[model samples]
Target: MAISRITTVEVTSEHIGVKGEPNISYIYSRYYRAPELIFGATKYTTAIDIWFAGCVLVELLLGQPLFPGESGVDQLVEIIKEKCVEEDYEI
Candidate 1:
């Protein structure tokens, strides 16, 4: 689960210690992080994993990352550009 971004995530099939809490760690790959994480959100949900999975699927299909930004800010910019083009928004 993406909750691994938290400092400690313990799972024993009986309990989950972490459940998408505020974790500002930069350990997670920037490419797959959800927009909320990029914006420094304190509270989030497992839906972030869905975003990560989608990014992985796209990378596998294209043989390259769909948003190959160099850093966190760059990653957000890449995502915004894609969204703009997708919604036909003027830049």
Candidate 2:
């Protein structure tokens, strides 16, 4: 299968929170979360959505999530692993 285009459907509720409020409870899906969100950044831009779009595109290309994590920590681990591999650094 091939992905010609990607569309942003309804934004997840995790991305919706009151400004200046502590965003410790809700979070985006682990597989598609942006790095900042993973790092507990409550103040972020729409770029997070763009990051999620990129992840979805990658999933479409690879036939699976590029980051298939089970939890927040697991998600960070997957990202770190990918970064280490890319930089040719030992983890």
Candidate 3:
């Protein structure tokens, strides 16, 4: 299978304001949203796009979303589960 890549076109956008600006709208697909965005961070950097690119890369490798959350909160939970949960830890 061909590995899909995230191109500049897929990641380009024209959001108003620069980094550290307050109350910036959270406008991103939930599956590819950065952790900062999920945490309601208004002042964020372009690093969020890098996070999105990583998510896309993971999906391309696994053929599914790394964090397949149904909602915003669920997305956070998925991230926490992946990062914080131990191999022996039970739900």
| Per-model TM against the reference | 0.68, 0.67, 0.70
Please list the residue runs of candidate 2 whose C-alpha ends up more than 4 Å from where it truly belongs after superposition: 2-27
Model 3 worst lDDT window (10 residues):
4-13
Predicted structure 1, TM vs. truth: 0.68
Alpha-carbon runs more than 4 Å astray in model 1:
1-17, 25-27, 86-90
lDDT, candidate 2, 1-91, per-residue tens: 7665564446566657565555642455678888788877876566765887898878878877888888988988888897686557766
What shift in Å separates residue 34 of candidate 2 from its native position after superposition?
0.8
| lDDT (Cα) of model 2 | 0.73
Give me the candidate number with maximum lDDT: 3
Report the Cα lDDT for residue 77, model 3. Answer: 86
Task: Estimate, for each residue in 42-90, the C-alpha lDDT of model 3 and write its tens digit.
Answer: 8767787688779878888887789999998899888888987577675
Task: Pick the TM-score winner.
Answer: 3
> Which digits, one per residue and each the tens of the lDDT, describe model 1 over residues 1-91?
1322222223353332146655553425787778887888756567666787798777767667789899888998899888787557764
Candidate 3 segments exceeding 4 Å error: 2-17, 22-25, 87-91
